[model samples]
Target: LVIDEIKGRDLRETLIAFGEHLMGAYMSPALIGVYRTVVAEANRYPTLGRTFYENGPARATGRLAEVLEAAEARGEIDADDCFRAASHFVGMIRDNLHLQVVLGLRPPPDADEARIAVLSAVDVFLNGVASHR
Candidate 1:
């Protein structure tokens, strides 16, 4: 009976979990969509779109910096906070780039992390725009 119980418990190791399927479904389009959204939104900003087109990653970082600067000038948030926010946003993007390749693990270890990162980036963008406006 005891051996049977252990085998039953160990059965989980033999079976593939369901979340692997979900992340596989979501991650690809997500990476592409996020890239497009970031580019599209940055373009909406004055001179930012061209800057991004000429130099992608450098421009993305620059856009975040510009947003941070505007936020600082408005006194709505601290500079370090903006920097941290942008760092997370960048990390999330970087992680998403990696996670798409490892979708077999249940729940995809970085899926939640990536979602939060994307949200953080969007939040910073919105807050920055409001500050500048």
Candidate 2:
């Protein structure tokens, strides 16, 4: 879903779309409840965590890695490890905001807030990985 939204876009645009998708997913109450349940039961059911990771985060990361690989081929970025880069990008998008939301310390970001967060992350990430020449 997210990969389809981000595919064929330029690096900045791709990151923006990706970030927005992540923010939407993270903000979903149903998903939050499911994640909380999964976390709370993870110790008792070890396979739950692995299952969640494989089905959710792992799939997202794999798709993002494909996007990053395409960006590298296009000379938009210079990533030696697309999968690691994809993970880093996801981490950056989540940041402290996601932690705060997950902990119930704050409400989910509004659209403007999400945009600002995503753009900031995209800029920083682009600066780090953009092709030197």
Candidate 3:
């Protein structure tokens, strides 16, 4: 059995670090690779299947919130639109990504079928967020 271990990191510290990177002050290719690897792994593993979707832990909440907040602050989108975009993003993550993790499907490469299934979810999320303007 492959057991996933959690490290004991302070949530606030982690959030701050994420904010720093996401705020565009510093971009981390490593972080992007990590997330890509996650998707790839989820595309693997048969048991993992399509359960990766709806996996709340896998959803990057810090990035999501920061993006919404930044957009609002810039007046790029109204509050209602910002919230709508966030909701759309969250919903897609829940229904597609989290759902895949729940199905026991490890990331892609191991489960290509699962990855294919969720692409539409990603598209929808992007479209929704962009529409928030």
Candidate 4:
């Protein structure tokens, strides 16, 4: 479902969809708890961190990087480093909402809120990634 959401009409639409799905997925308490536990035990259990990265954020970032690289190849984006751009794209959309949810500052946003948040992040990210001729 998440991966399907990422395939959109264009790069910007794809990013917006990706951000929306990501926000939806991360809103889960179980996922948030897993993140907290993984971070807390990372030092004592290195493999835990490695496992989390391999199964979670790294996978997402890698997938997005592939898309970004394709866009770059097509001359749609001027990305010097697609992997780094992927990371920034996900981080920009996810970090603040995830933090707010984890800290109990706010509940996971509803559908309308998610739309607004994802679109806003996509706008900012698109601006940053725009080719400066």
Q: Which lDDT tens digits does candidate 2 get at residues 1-133?
A: 6577667778788888887888788777777788888999999999999999899888888888999999898888888999999999888887898778878999888989988998998888888656779
| Model 2: ten consecutive residues of lowest lDDT | 1-10
Of 3 and 4, the candidate ahead on lDDT is 4
Tens digit of per-residue lDDT, candidate 1, span 36-128: 565568746846666545564454445555555565676655666665655554444445544454443334336566555455545553454
Instruction: Give the TM-score of each candidate.
Output: 0.34, 0.90, 0.33, 0.87
lDDT-sorted candidate list, best first: 2, 4, 1, 3
Q: Any runs in candidate 2 off by more than 4 Å, and if so which?
A: 129-133
Ranking by TM-score: 2, 4, 1, 3
TM-score, candidate 1, is: 0.34
Q: Rate the local accuracy (lDDT) of all candidates.
A: 0.46, 0.85, 0.42, 0.84
- Model 1 C-alpha RMSD vs. true structure (Å) is 18.2
At residue 36, give the lDDT of candidate 1: 59
Candidate closer to the true structure by lDDT (higher is better), 2 or 3 = 2
* Candidate 4 per-residue lDDT over residues 39-94, each given as its tens digit: 88999999999999898888989988988988898888998999999999889878
Model 4, runs deviating above 4 Å: 1-8, 129-133
Q: What is the C-alpha RMSD of each candidate to the true structure, in Å?
A: 18.2, 2.8, 13.2, 2.8
- Model 1: residues >4 Å from true position, as ranges? 1-54, 80-85, 102-117, 120-133
